[model samples]
Structures are given as C-alpha cells and as structure tokens.
Target: MKKIILTLFTAIAVLALAACSSTSGASKDKEITLGATAGPYTDMVNKAIKPSLEKKGYKVKVVEFSDYIQPNLALSKGDLDANLFQHKVYMENFAKEKNLKLSEVVVVPTAPMGLYSNKFKSIEEIKEGSTLAIPNDPVNLARTLIMLKDAGLITIKEDTNQLTASEKDIKDNPKNLNFKPLEAAQLPRAVQSADVAAVPGNFALAAKMDLLDALQLENMPDTYRNRVVVNTKDLESAFAKDIKEVVESKEFEEVIDKEFKGFGKPEWMKK
Candidate 1:
C-alpha cells in the first residue's frame, strides 16, 4: 500500500513538471497557433490576420475545429496560443462553467443576426400570426429574441435574463408571430418556408446569404461580437499583446471591408 501511494505521487509530480515545462517552452517561441471554428473564421485568420503577423517576424499557424467547444478547450490546455471563434458572452460563460481562466484579447468584426423573409419583402409587410424560425439553442435563441424585440415585433419581460431568454420570456407578441425553433444551419432554409427566420450572422454567411438583404440586421451589442480569446494567465504575454495589436491595425479593417463585408465592426474598431 505504501509503495503504491509513493509511486502514484511520483507519477503525478512528473506529469505536473512536464505540463509546466511544455507551457514555458511554448511561451518563449515566436511561433503561435490560433484555433478557429472551421470556415470563414479560419479563412479570416489565413487571408487577413496571418500575413500581417508573418510580416512582423512571427510564424502564425491556424488550427481549424469543426465544433465550438474544442477551440476553447485547446486554448485552456495550452494546445493553442489563442483562439478566435467566440463572443465575449460565450467566453465568459464557458470559463465560469468549466472553472477555467480565460480572457478576451480583442473583439473583431462579427456577422450580426439578420431577420429574413422569402415571401414578405419587407418588415412592414410581416402579417399577424406569421411564423418565425429561431435557433433552439439557449444563447442564440436569446439573440433571436432580442433581435425580434429590437425589430418591434415582440416585447421581452422586464428584468429578464436576456442571455438565456426564451419564447416563454416574451411579454407580448404584437405581430402574433409564432416561433419555430430549429438547428441554426436549418435557418437559412427556413426563410424559404417559414414566414420569417432570424438567422445568426455566422450561419447566414455559411449559407452565402447577403446580410444587407435581411429586413433588419441585429444591432449587436459589444458582448455579442466575436473576439480573440487567450488564457487569463497569458494576458500579459507578448504574443497575446501582438494579437490585440494586429486586430486593431488598419490592415485588418481593410480586409474586413474587402473580404468579409456585412460583418459589423466592434465598438473599439469603430473608434
């Protein structure tokens, strides 16, 4: 029993030392790995952010993930130096839920959710009892609800926790809009059938729908805008600072205009 306990303690100590050593070696290198959800964001890092960093003497490698959770998990585990697929709300919530220390490096241009209709040509044309398709997931459902409220079609309850708000939190539906919650990817298709579909910005872009064509685009709050995220312990690191600087650069915004049109700029970028 004593020998088994001693051996387990020794193994644990060695693993801890290896983790620290790996982190120490990683922080000293000029090479950086940035994680993103596959598609536009991966392309954004490759086409826009990567070249700028390369010119400044850093080797920037981007890793693409198919899902939302892995990028942050990889970031927390130090497999990535930084990541760029999440909004501040997601980062804060994920960090709290997982008991991880993560912080935003900077907010970037985000595609805003848009209210679209195939039959009704305009917001004014939306009729009573028109069915609206919304994301079923809690956070995105909240976004859709908020956007609907902003469009003057609905009223969310006062003092409501809007981040997790659902159809039940709606105090009034002036248009008598019936919400059909669906997987986010299905929303673009919903516009063809449903009277109105509130599509989040990322999915709309994936479907190649023109954001400006929507009857209304979400006036996204700062918290909702996607941002660069890094581990909290690395907040003061040189590479982290460089990531913020690159996002703030004029070149980055120029790319946003040329390659990623219709994604709204963050407030910091607006200034």
Candidate 2:
C-alpha cells in the first residue's frame, strides 16, 4: 500500500508540472505583434510606443516590411496582430479589393507626400516639357496627381476624385509635362532621372532627401491621416487595446514632434 501511494503522488506531481508549463507558454503567446513600414513609422514604434506599452504590462513586438503590401497581407492572414502603415483611404481601397476584414484602430501620423526635385528649387523653377515621376500604384498615383494639381503644375478633370485618377484624367497640361508613373519605393531614386518626383514622406526620409525646403507638399485634410489597423474580428482583443494605447499616447506624440519634426504630425496632434 505504501508503494502504491508513493507512485500515485509522483504521477500527480508530474501532471502539475506539465499544467504549469502549458499555462506559461499560453501567457507568452498572448504578446501583441505589430507591423509597420521600415522608416519613420518603425522608428516611432520603437522609440515611443514600445516602451510605454511595456510599462503597461504588455509585450509588443514590431515587425518591419520594406514596401507597403506585405504588412496588410500578413495581418489579413493572421500572421500579425496589427499594422501601422497606411492611411484610411488606402486601407478602405485595399480591403475592398482583397476582401479582408481589417479595421483602423487609431490615426497615428500623416506623412504628407511631397514633390521633390534636385533639378528645381521650387515649382516655378520647373520648365515647360519637364518630365515628372509619379507613383505607379493606383492609389498613390492618384495622390501624386492631386498634389501636382494642388501645386498648379497640372489640371485634372473637374469630376475626378482621390479614388479614381489616371493619365487620362489630366485636363490641361500647359507645359506638356511628361508623367512617368513608377512604383512608390522607386520614386525617390527616380528623381535623378526626372525633373521632379513625387515621393512619400517615409521613403523620402529613408533616401535622406531634404524635402523640408526642396519640394512642395500636398495640403492634406484631417480625413487623410494614417492609422494603426487590426483584423476586424480581433478589434476588441487585448493586443488591439495595447496598440491603441501606444499609438494615442502623449509619449508617441512627443517623439513624432522631436524626431520627425512637423512632417508626420497627425491632425489630432495639431489640435
């Protein structure tokens, strides 16, 4: 009887140990995984958001992608808990096309697209028949065209909007300027090949392009602010809550102002 009791106690101890190990593994798996583009957005996450979130007892892991497409693809496929890479307009268009159920958690920052040129110091300096490079992607191509229109460099048809604009949309080209649409990632480098290039803020910074005084930026409205996004199904998850707190925190805002200057400030910060 003594031998049997001893054996039973040993079995119970082993089971308890296994249970504790399983629980610990489960807890570690609860850490939130976030994705962002590989520039100022990733920098902001590391410098401001991650430390604040750690203080709040949440594990935050940031994954960086080289270009725009992979982050959303990962989030939709359940590989990431959230992404901080795109504006609402872009997200809406992506969601509709891909049939993904992702939702924006909060507006983080706005990297207003700027038209930069090594050949010209100002818009007035751009000559007739000047060749310009724009982003080839549909959404960004439209955005670049709009910026050009805003700068009075070109004119689009009156009915055109952000959702739809093509080379065909150009109504007036006084200079008969050449429109060369390239990928967003390629725009900065293409500046050397063209008279002017419309480049996104993050990529411009990555290329060490001095856009502050070198180019003209489009006037972005409050509606175009970029955001942190997550799967709609997981909107109420702990990970989403943690990401929201990190993005909307004062620390994050301070870092944006200090590191990025005024180039990437969200409308909320302007208030």
TM-score of each: 0.85, 0.78
C-alpha local distance difference test of each model:
0.89, 0.81
User: Compared with the true structure, what per-residue lDDT tens digits does model 1 show for residues 1-271?
Assistant: 9999999999999999999998777655779899999878898899778898888778788899999999999998889999989998788889999999999888888899999998888888999999999998998999888888888888999988867888789999988888898999899999999999999988898898999999999888888988888999999998889888888899998999999888888898777
Off by over 4 Å in 1: 1-28
Error of 2 at 203 (Å): 3.0
Q: Model 1's lDDT to the true fold? A: 0.89
| lDDT by residue (tens digit), candidate 2, 1-271 | 9999999999999999999999888668667787888887888778877888788766788999988899999999888888887888779888999998888888876667898888898899999999998888887777778888889988999998766678889899888898887888899898888998889776788888765855788676545667889999988977777778777778877787777764656666667
Number of clashing residue pairs, candidate 2:
0
Report the CA-based lDDT of candidate 2 relative to the real structure: 0.81
For candidate 2, the per-residue lDDT at 64 reads 94
